[model samples]
Structures are given as C-alpha cells and as structure tokens.
Target: MRVLITGGTGFIGAEVVRQLVAEGGHDITVFHVSGSQRRLADVADRVTLIRGDVGNISHVLDAVKTARPQAIFHLGAILSTASDLDPSAAMHANVNGTFNVLEAARILDVPQVLFASSIGTYGLGMTGPHIDDLTVQRPLSFYGTAKLFGEGAGNFYRHRYGLDFRGIRFPGICGPGVRTPGAAQFHSWVVEECAKGRPYTIEVAPHTRVPIVYVRDAAAGVLALARAPRERLVQFNYLINGVPPTPSAEQLADAVRARVPGARIDFRVDPQRQAFIDRLMKPVDDRFAREEWGWNPAYDTDAMLDDFLAELAAHPQRYPD
Candidate 1:
C-alpha cells in the first residue's frame, strides 16, 4: 500500500507511521511541518519525509501529487488549546486544511482518505449515559467545531465524489510525548511526570472522568476503519472508546502511583479547566465502530499503563520530561 500521512510526527500520527512500517508492504511518506519530525527519528530511514503545512493548499496539493498514495491519512490540525487561543489559525489549519486535503484527494483520485476526528465533536446538550455514533454533535470549542466541519466535509466528498472517506472520532488520546495543552492532557501528563520520578498535580478534581484511548489503540483504530470494506461501512465516520469503565481522575492517579512507586500525584482543581472538562465527561459508545470494523483495543488500563511506562523507560530520548 502506498500511504501518505499528514501530521505523521504527532503523538498518534507517529504511532500510525510506526505501525505501518512494522506491518510491512507499505510505501510510506510523511507530510509534516518542519522541526516536528523528532518522533519519526527511529523510522527516519524507512519512510520519505515531506515538510509542509496542511493549512497551505499548495502544500497539500504538492504532497498528494508527490506521494500519489493509495490512502491519505489526514491527521493534521491545530489542537484544542491552540485552536481556542487563535480561531483564525484554527480556521486556516483545521477547517481550510481539511478542505485542502479532500480537494487534493478528489483531484488526484486517491482510493481512500482516513480522518482523525475527536470526541470533542460532542459538547454541551448531550443527553445519554454514553455518547454514540448518532449523538448530536454540538461542539462548543473552536477545535471541536473545526473537526465537526471536517466530518461534514468528508461526508460531502464521499457522497458527491465517491471518495472512500472514513473517520474515527477519538476520545482523549493518552500516551507519552503529548505536550499539547487541553483539559484532558492530564491523562498523559500524570503518567509521564510520574515515569520521570516527578510529582505532578492534576488540574481537575479526583472524581472527574474523561474517556481516553491509549495512543497506540487510537492509531490502530484509524487504520482499522480505513481498511474496512466499503460495503460494511454504514456510516462514513465512527466514534471509538478506549479500555473500559472509564477511569476517574483518582483511579488514573492510583494507576500511575501503582506503576511508578512513590509517585506523588496531587489534585488542585482549576475551576475554569474543570468546567471545560465537565462538558466532555460523557463515556463514548463505539459499538458502531466495533461492529463495522473490528475496532477492539488491545490494552486495558493496566496494559496501557504498563506499555506506556515501558516505552518511556526504554526510550527516554523519545519521551523526555
């Protein structure tokens, strides 16, 4: 398979790249901004690296033209904190950038385009024990709004142009090297800080619960959705949950402390951030994803934490404190 991945150096994108390389038979090309390729250092020799911004249509066009990939994994976008900080930049990078990718794929006749959407797409006004594929997406944040736009655009392209567009709405993607600021980032930071033998503070309350998927599972879910037969896909995009029972902040802290002995984790809830998290505490229902495309995550909480700590310890250079 000839594959092109945007934002391929990011936390989840990097994992996707590594998995593709390990799976073999993939001619991979990573379309990424400069200076962000640190995560690709290990697999630098295995894939072609193209430096470009997804916000730039010309860059997106050039990358698609150059790779002419069988599949384009569109994972590039400004995240929650950055998007909220500057809506204009997010408009360009997240909104316009998605348009550019879809346009490029349409013009170039790419067979499939996989997208990385988010659970952020569901915001206030959600009424259910858990959010499912059919839930109304009334995204509150700029980043969430942009992703919802991406999902809408993708559906348009798929119906209007017959493009094989598919997406996975991810929950909080937790893993090492997640430096991006967000209400849910503590999912990764608490574990990471403890792995480095440092005391860390959780900005949200101990009882706060946000559904999270380990980064590897996140990457794999996207790939699985991409690989599913078109006849089997009832929806163009699907929501995916990770692990089970949705661990609370206190449970997450306990897990970290258990793995990293003597790990000091404190909670000094920030009312503002807590409010932001409160809007996104709904557990995800990914039954559609599971039924449509074997979307089972390999790691439970213990398995995810064990692998995360092992990765941090084995490759300190990749995930520095």
Candidate 2:
C-alpha cells in the first residue's frame, strides 16, 4: 500500500511510520512542516519527505497528488499548549488542516483516511466513572473543539461520499521524544526527563488521573483499525483507552522512580491546567475498538515503564538534555 502521513515527523506519526517500515511492503510519503527530518531519523531514508502545511489546501493537495497514496494518515495539528496560546493557529492547523485532508481524499478518490482525534472532545461535561461509546462531545478548549469538528466532518464524509474515514480518540500519549507543549504532556515529559537524569516538576496534581497510551501501542492501534473491514465499522471513529483504569501522576511518577533510580520528579497542581484535563479524565471504555478491530495494548503501565526506561538507555542519543 502507498501511504501518505501528515505530521509524519511528530511523536505518534513517527511511531506509525516505524510500524509501516517494519511491515516491509509499503511506500511511505511523509508530509511534514518545512521538511524537519529531526524526529524521522531512522526511517527518513525510506520515506519520501515533502514540505507542506496541512492548513494550506494547496500544500495538502499537492502532497496527496504527488504521493497518490491509497491510505492517508491525517495526524497534523497544533496541540494543547500551542492551541491555548494562539487559538487562531489551532483553527488553521487543526480545523482547516483536517478539512484539507478530507477534501484531498474526496477529490482524489483515496481509499481510506485514518484520523487522529482526541479524548478532549468529551470535555467538562464528561462527569462519569466511565465514558462509554455514546458520550457526547462538548470540547472545552479550541484544540478539542477543532478535533470534534474533524470527527463530525469525517463521519459526514463517510456517510455522504462513502469515504473510508476512521478515527481513534487518543488520551495522553506517553513515550520518549515528545516535544510538543501540551498540559498533559508532562506525563511523558516526566518519564523522558527522568531517563536523562534530569530533574523535572509536573504541573498537574499528584493524584490527578488521566487516560494514557504508549507510543508503540498507539501506532499499532491505528494500523489495526485501518486493516479492519470497513463493513465491521458501525461507527466512523472509535475510542481507544491505551491505559485503562487510568493511572495517576503519582502512579506514573512512582513507576518512573522505580525504574530510573536517582531520578527526581516533583509536582505542583496548576488548578487551571488540571481542570481542563480532569474534565476529560474519565475511564474510557474502548471495548468497541477491541471488538470492532482487534485493538489491544501490548503494554500495561508496568510493561510500558520498563520498556520506556530500556529504550532511553539504549538510545540516549535519541533524547538529549
């Protein structure tokens, strides 16, 4: 399969690219901003990297036409912190960016589109011990709002045009090499910083809970969704809870301490930031994803932490202080 991945140099996109390379039979074209190949180090040679902004339809259309990809992974967006700082940029990158991808797919008759949505869609109103598949989306932030729009728009495309658009609602994705400035990103930041023997303070509360997925499992889940028969998909997108029974900051920090001895990880609860995340922190039921497309996480918190530390150790060059 020929694949086109926007934001292919990003955290999750990089892992998705690695998985595609490991599978060994696909031509991958990465549509990234200004051709930053920094995060795409290992697989850079294998992929055809194109410089383009998804916010610009022309840039997206050009990449799609050039790659002529049968499968498109639409993953580019301005994340939480950046979005909070300048919502206009988020609108441009997240809202318009998603639209451009859908338009390109529709215009070119692309077979499939795999979108990366966020759990943020179920914002402040998600007051529950558990968030089921039927929860309504009332996003609190500009970032979440744009993501919700993408979800609704993708579904519309699927229904109106038979566009094979499928999406996954991700939580706080944790792993090494995440440079984006999202509030919840501190979850991953703590782990990565600790691995490098650097002291760091988490901004969220010690006991605040949140959904999380390891980078590897996140990428695997997306690929599995793409492989499933479209007929099996009763809905256009599915929720994926990577770490169920969602771990707390303290739990994750404790795990990091246990793995990386002498690591110093502290915290202070920023009420504002914590509020936004807490609103979307309910236990997400991803049984739909499991039954629909055989999505299963390879690592639990324990397994994930172990591998995280090990990977950082083996590839210290990957994460510099």
Candidate 3:
C-alpha cells in the first residue's frame, strides 16, 4: 500500500517511516517543505521524497495524484511556541494545512487518514485527573486551537464525504531524531542535553508533570489506528495517552543525572513556556483508546529515558564533536 506522510521528516514521522520500511513492501512518499529539516536521510532511497506545502491545495492534489496512497498520515503542523508567537503562521500551517490534506483525501477517496492532534488541545487550566476523549477542550494556544479545529474538520470530512478519519491526541513525543522546536521541547531537550553532559536551564518548575511518549511508541500508535478496521472506530477521534514516565521535572532530571553523572539542571520557569507545557503535562486518561483499539504504550518514563540514553550513548559521535 502506498502511504504519503506530510512532515514525514519530523521526529515522529521519521520513526513512522522507519517502521513502515521495516515492515516492508509499502510505497512511501514524504511531503516536506522547501527547507525544513530533513530527518528522513536514512530512508532517502526507500521513500519517494516530494517537496510541497500541505497548506496548498494544488501541492497536496499533485502529491496525492503522484503517490496514489491508500492511507495518509497527516503529521504536519506548527509547534506550540511557534504557533503562540505567530498565530497567523500557525493558522496557515495547521488549519489551512489540514484543510488541504482533508480536502485532497476527500477528493481522491483515500481510505484512511490518521491526523495528528496534540494533547495541548485539551485546553488551559486543567486541574487534576487524566483527560479523556470526553473532556472539554478549551485550547489556550493557537497551536492547540488549530489542532482542535483540525479534529473538527476531520469529523466533517468523515461524516460528509465518508472519509475514514482518525485523530490521535499525542503527548509530548520524545526520541532520537531531528530535534523539534516547541514548548514541549523540555521533554526530549533535557534528555539530549543531559546525555551530552551539558548544563542546561529547565524552563518549567521541577514538579510540573506532563504526559510523554517515546517516538517509536507514538509512531506505533499512529500505525495501529491507520490499520485498524474502520468499523471499530465508532468515535471520530481517539485520545491516546503515552505513558508519562514521571511527570515531575526533578524526577526527569534525576534520571538524566543518573545516566550522565554530574549533569546540571537549573530551574528557570518561563511563564509562557510553562502555560503550554502545563496543559500537555496534565493528567489525562486514555481508556478510550485502550478499549476501542487496544492501544497501549510499550515504554514507561524510566524505560523511555533508558532507551534514549542508550541510543545516544551507543553513538557518541552523533552529537557535536
């Protein structure tokens, strides 16, 4: 089956590409912006790399025609910080970008589309208890607003055009790949910094808790929903909680320190940064995804950190000399 993944060169998208290629025999096309980070360097030969913007209808239409993919993983979007700073850019990339993808899929009759939505869509001021599929989302950032809007558009496409749309609300995804710029950078940023034995300032308070997922598991969740039987998903969108290793910032720091002796961590809270991180770190239940699609993450917080350090340690040269 041919699969076209927008933002296929990103952290999660790169893992998705690896998983798909490892699974074998599927034609893959990566839709990338002109000068965006190209994380798909390893699979350059395996995937049909197409340069285009998901915000443009013609770009998407042409890619759709060229790939003729049965499934689409729509992972393209601006990050929380970037969106908050320049909402117009976020709107163009997230909202308009999603519209283009959904419209193209509707026009081409793509079988399934796994749209990437963030836990940030859960809104600001969430206190206690894990958010579920039924939780009301009062997004506090443009990025979240755009994601929520994308979910709504996906629902519209599904109901109006019979397009199979599946939305996955992801936690902060972390792993060894291209470093993404966003408010949630704290999750993987600290890990990378600590692994390199480099001192870094943590933007959030130590106790700030947020859900996180290893890139591999996040990609796995997407693939699972993409391959799930359409009849199984009665609900339009699925909120998947990737396990929060230990939401405490100190706990994450300790894990890093333990891995890299004498790793330095200074607490310097960025108010605006904290706002975005707070929502994602809020406790949210994922029983819906579990009951609906048997979705469960393979790594806990400790496991994720261990895996991350192991990967980095195995290849010390991957980082700057």
Candidate that would win on TM-score: 1
- Candidate lDDT (C-alpha), each: 0.90, 0.86, 0.81
Candidate 2: residue 94 lDDT (0-100):
96
Candidate 1 TM-score over all chains jointly? 0.98
**In model 2, how large is the Cα lDDT of residue 132?**
61
Per-prediction TM-score to the true structure, in the order listed: 0.98, 0.95, 0.92
Candidate 1 deviant stretches above 4 angstroms? none
lDDT of 2 by residue, 1-321 (tens): 999999888888988999999889899999998455666687789989999889999999999999999999998888877897899989999999999999999999998999999887886566667876788788777888899999999999988999999999988888987887886788788988877778989999888887888899999988999899987887667888775667789988998898888999888878888886666677778888988888899888998888888878887766665
Q: Candidates 1 and 3: which is better by TM-score?
A: 1
Superposed model 2: Cα runs more than 4 Å off = none
Each prediction's RMSD over C-alphas, in Å, is 1.0, 1.5, 2.2
- Model 1 over residues 1-321: C-alpha lDDT tens digits? 999999998888899999999999899999988585778788899999999989899999999999989999999888999999999999999999999999999999997899989888988778888899999899989999999999999999999999999989988989999888988899999999888888899999999989889999999888888888999999779999897978999998998888888999999989999987886667788899999998999988899999999998888888764
Report model 2's TM-score to 2 decimal places. 0.95
Name every residue pair that clashes in candidate 3: 130-283, 130-284, 130-285, 131-284, 210-281, 245-301
